[model samples]
Target chain A: MNAIVTVLRKEVRDTLRDRRAVLSSLAGALFGPALFAVFMNFTVERTIDEGEAAIEIPVVNAADAPNLVGYLGQHLIEAKEAAFDSREELRASVRRGETEVGLVIDKQFGTALGEGKAARVWIVADRANASAQTAVARVRGALRSYSSLVGVLRLQLRGVDPGVARPLAILNDDVSTPSGRSVLLLGAFTYFLLFACFLGGLHVAVDSTAGERERGSLEPLLTLPVSRGALVAGKFAATAFFMAVALIIGIAAFAVAVDYLPLAEVSMDADLGLVECAMAFAVLVPIAVLGAGLLNAVTAFTKSFKEAQSYSGIAMLLPTLPILLIILNPMQPTISMMLVPSLSQHLLITSIVKAESIDPLYFAVSATSTVAIGALFGLLAVWRYRSEKLLV
Target chain B: MIEAEGLTKRFGDVVAMDDVSFRADDGRVTGLVGPNGAGKSTTLRVLCTVIKADSGRARVDGVDVAARPLDVRRQIGALPHLSGLYPNLSARENIAYYAEMQGMPRREAGRATRTVIDRLGIGDLSDRRAKGFSHGQSIRVALARALVHRPQTVILDEPTNGLDVVATRALRDVILDLRRDGRCVLFSSHVMQEVAMLCDELLIISEGRVAISGTPDEILRETGCGDLEDAFVAAISSERESK
Candidate 1:
């Protein structure tokens, strides 16, 4: 234990002294949450602002479509970016990214609406791409609701009373925790954690091995009374400490980002209080351990500093797989799943995002297994230390 | 005390060492001098128990290097040909790290680190990272680390390979000091002059075998040469010509 402490302390002190190491750690911490917050703010603004804006369409004849397209145009801006006469050019323009959305109001649009016959309205878009798709969907929905209202009003204007046009009415009474919430806003926080873990400890691990060897300092280390195992343990501990510090900063940034970022005004389902944020931080520690272990072991095995760094980058890629999977599927956290290191924690992380309780058994398994896996990394680092090939 | 009895090592068909044998008393410095590729480092590595010998047995402090490998390692300080120093650590830290590994107390290890660095005139450089140190400074730190715990025997492979004039002389003085302290100092070098100047006894290895092992005077007399280099030339000339 004393040996390990001595080794760990040396590493910690060295890391604290290197300016580049600390700066990179802080950069890794802030980068993710800041980017995610910006993305979230943009998403909400796009939805609300676009919903209130005008829908663009080309009315072929002003008199022809008095009913649908003509009526809808009154409520939206009509941007005449393309001519309706050239079908091929319109299609090419959409394909070549000339426009996000396009609408064509046919010659018979007003006549068909007035006579209550079949009316054709064409919607043209360049690969909807979520934002454009949402705008199109909202615009189409508004037109449909307005048409029905106009139809009922026409009946009232003819002979019947306004209330008699519609005999029955439906009302939505939703007792939501937060009304009109976006799920992505909650998910951005988890993504931020994943980003911070894999990138934080990479440089230190690289510098400790290949950089040392190339500079001719590694030989002196091996000659020391310190056992190779102790050396590895010390190195692994230092890197893990750096990663943990980075992760803590990351979790804090995310918590603060979630709280202070304009998220209060936007509706969200999951709310992270002080206690919940603390739990999330507790979960991040084991993940940082797992990350630090793999990074150190892999870095030790590599031939040079650059090689170790490149390999560490590849190792970093593995953790993101679980995060990406969760983003695509968004499942509840399951502690029983132990196929990946800290995957069970990701499950807990996902639960935290959805405002669900963390599974205790899964949490225990994740914590135990991640710690075990981290020890295995230390064992591997020791094994590397014992090897003449790795030492060279 | 160190003893090697017909120690042999081979990689498949290529023999690195063949029935090599020698002894080093507990209170003397024994030098191993040989040309490049004469199995000097390989023999030292086997003696250090860093690698296994093929057949014959050897011992460091009466423990078999082959059979009881870790026991031999526990009693020996080996400075390999290649410097394995960690660049991030200072001279003191490097020495302290090794001392701590050898089971020296933290306080004692710290003291040993200071003593050696100051002895080698690297006291001012002790706190600086080893990355920028000259080859001489690096070797000084390595030597300090090697003796930090004072193992039963010291095995150095090409210790002064890259030393400048001043550093080389300083190293010779340290080797002499270690001998005065009565520690077994076994060093391998390519330079016969260094072996002649420093070693009280010499073991000249050639063609993966000890061509000569005796005092400098005996080698000079037997080979009919005035100096150790001439004796080496007189002994290995035929072999070199044949190759």
Candidate 2:
């Protein structure tokens, strides 16, 4: 135990003095939060701006339907006189993306309305253009309302009640809360936190194993009167320490970055506060042990520092796989899912951000399972160290 | 003291050490002189507990290397073929790290580190990080690190592989000092002149086997050679012809 502590202290002190390692860890921790802030801010601002802005549609024959155009104007749909003379031209313009949607009134529209016959109108739009769908919907809605108003007036003229014309009323009920709406975006927050934790220990893990061997220190180091298990344990502990630090920093940075996001503008509440951050840190921190263990185990197989670095780069991506799968096909938290390390932490973090009550049983299972697997990897590293092949 | 009897280690089909036997005693410098690829390093590695011999008994101060490697490691200090130091750590810290690993208390390790640094005459270079150290400076720091624990036996593999005239002389003085202090010093060298100058007992190895081992004069007289260098060639050639 004393030997373990000695090796741990030496490794940690040596890593701290390495400027490149320290800087890389710091950079990784900050990179995720800064990117999340910028992306969230852009998305929130665009959604809010698009919600309030008026939509414009070019009308092929605006003069023929002054009254109809006037009604659309009241619904925040502006009608501009189009340069084109025919409906074909309007269709081409909409298809070319020069206009989101175009209005084309039939040549016989005025006569048909005078004779009390049905009049024709066309809304030219490309349904596949996602950005243009909003304008198309707005224009279609205004036209329908105008048609209903005229029909209601016609019913009154005939001394029939307007209510008799409509037999059904439809309403929409949405159940998602403000915080619940933000959980999808905050899922990324947990991913970044986990990634930062892994990154924090990468240098130390590679340095202690492959770097030590490459520098010719492993032989001398193994010659010391300490058990290989104790040495591995010490190195593992130091790596875990750095990872935990990075996790803390990531949680704090995300907490601050969340405040700058305009989630409220989109009716989404970012519940990432001091308490939530603390909870998240607690939930995600155990994976650092797993991260350190895994990294050390993988790098131990490499022959040189450069080879270990490249191999570890790929190894670090393992944690993110479960997160990506969960995001694409979300599942409710279950006992079996808690058995998986990164997936369990992700579910817990998502629940925390959504402001849901966490089950202590789930936390216990998740934390215990994660640490158990981490210890297994730690033991694997020790086994590798004990092998004579390690010196080769 | 270090002893190996009928030690043999093989890497797959290539035998690295074959029936190698020798004794390095306290209060004397024993040189394992061989050309590159000979078993000098392999023998040292086995004694230092870095690797195990396949088919023989090796002991450091009568502690079996295979049965009790940790105990054997405690009895010896080794400088490997490469002067491996943590580039980011100062020379003092490097030495102290080894001292602590040897089970010294923190304060005692620090004191021991200081003593070794001063004794090696490397106090001026102790505080500097090892990244910028020249080969000579690195060797001195590595030597200090190895001696910080003051084990009964010290094993160095090619300690003077690359050193200037001044550095080599300084290293010779340190080796002599270890002998005077009654510590067993076992070092390997490929250079015949270096082995002739420093070795109180010499073991000549060729092709993974001991060709001849004795005092310089004894080897010269036995081989009917006028000097140690010619005796080394004659012993190696005779061993090869017999094989």
Candidate 3:
């Protein structure tokens, strides 16, 4: 036990003295929260602005449909006279993305309305353009409303009830809460946290195993009086310490960064207060052991520091695999899923962000199973250290 | 004291050590001299308990290397062929780290570290990080790290591979001091002059087998050569002829 502590203290001091390693480890912690804040804020702001802003669309023959243009103005959709003389020109401009949406009124529109016949009009738009879809929908809705109003007037003139034209009315009632709606966006937040946790221990894990061997220090170290198991345990503990530190920093940064997002403008709530941050830290910290163990085990197989680094870069992605899988195919939290390491942490953290109740049994199973796998990896590292080929 | 009996190790089809046996007593410096790839390093590794022999028995200070490696390691201080130091740690911290691993308390390890640093007369180099140290400076610090525990047996695999005149003389003095303190010292070398100048007992190994071993005068008389270098060559040739 004493030897483990001694090795841990020495490794920590050694890594701290290396300015480059320390910076690389902690940089991930800050990067995740900063990106989360900037991206989410921009998205929310754009969505809110798109809803209330008025849009302007060009019309090919404004003189042919003055009354239709006047009716569109009431819905905050302004119509401007097109510079082009033909409908083809309007269609070309919309296709080239110079205009979001355009209108082409038929020459006989007024005569058709007088005869009580269906008028011809074209709403020219590129449906493939995501930005133009909203504009197209708004213009189409205004035209449909104008047609319905004309129908109602024509029926009233005949002494018929307009309500008879619409037999039933459909209404949408959404039951999702504001916090629950934010869970999908905040799923990315859990990914960042897990990535930072893995990155924190990468340097120490590579340094203690492959770095020592490359430096030719492992041979002399093995000749010491201490058991190989104690040595491995100490190195693993140091890696875990760095990983936990990164987890804490990431959680704290997210908690503060979430406050700056315009979530209220979009009617979304992120439960990232101090209490939630603490809960997230609790749920995510157990994965650090698994990360440290996995890194150490992978690095032990490599012969040099550079080789270890390349392998560890791939190894760190293992825990994040569960996060990606869960994101792509979201599943309800179950006790069986809680047995997986990163997936469980992601689920528990998502629940914390959504302000949902968590089962204590899930937490217990996740922590224990994750730690058990970590210990197994740790033992594998120790066993490798004991091999005669380690010196080679 | 160190002893090996019929020690043999093989890596697949390559035979590294072939029935090698030798003994180095306390209070004397024993030199294992051979050409390159003569299994000098492999033998030292086995004796230090860093590796095990496939079919042999080796002991350090009367402790079996295979049965209780930790006990064997406790009695020996080894300097491998490539002695490397942690670049981020100072010389003192590196030595103290080993001292602590040797089961010393924090305060005691610090004291031992300072004592070893002073004994080597490398006070100026103790406080600086090892990143920029030259080859000779690195070897000196590595030697200090090995000796901080004051083990009963010292094993070095080519300790003077790369050293200037002054550094070589300093290392020679340190080896003499170990002999004066009555600790068993076993070192390997490919250079004939180094072994002649310092070794009290010499073993000439060639092709994974000991060609000859005795006092310098005894080897010279046995090979019928006037000089130690000629005797070394003659013994190696005769061993090859016999094989």
Best by lDDT: 2
Model 1 Cα lDDT, one tens digit per residue, B1-243: 889989887766777787889998877889998889888978887787666777888888888876776567668887888666666678788788778767778898888788777776778778888768888888888888887777779899999998899999999998888888888999999998888888888998887777778988988888888888889877767545554
Backbone atom clashes (below 3 Å) for every candidate: 23, 0, 0
Flag regions of model 2 displaced more than 4 Å: A113-118, A159-165
Runs in model 1 lying further than 4 Å from the true structure:
A53-135, A156-192, A207-228, A329-335, A387-392, B11-13, B66-75, B237-243
Model 3 ranges off by over 4 Å: A149-159
Q: TM-score of each candidate?
A: 0.85, 0.97, 0.97
What is the overall TM-score of model 3 with all chains considered together? 0.97
Clashing pairs in 3: none
Candidate 3 residue-wise lDDT, B1-243, digit = tens: 999999999989888899999999999999999888889999998998888999989888888999999888878988888877999999999999999999999999999999999999989999999998988898899999999989889999899998899999999999999999999999999898999999999999988899999989899988899999999999888877987
In model 2 chain A, which range of ten residues has the least summed lDDT? A48-57
> lDDT tens string, model 2, A131-234?
88767787888889899998888889889999999998778898999999998778798789888999999999999999999999999999999999999999
lDDT of 3 by residue, A337-364 (tens): 9999999988998888889888999999
Which 10 consecutive residues of model 3 chain B have the lowest summed lDDT? Answer: B234-243
Query: Per-model C-alpha lDDT, please?
Result: 0.74, 0.91, 0.91
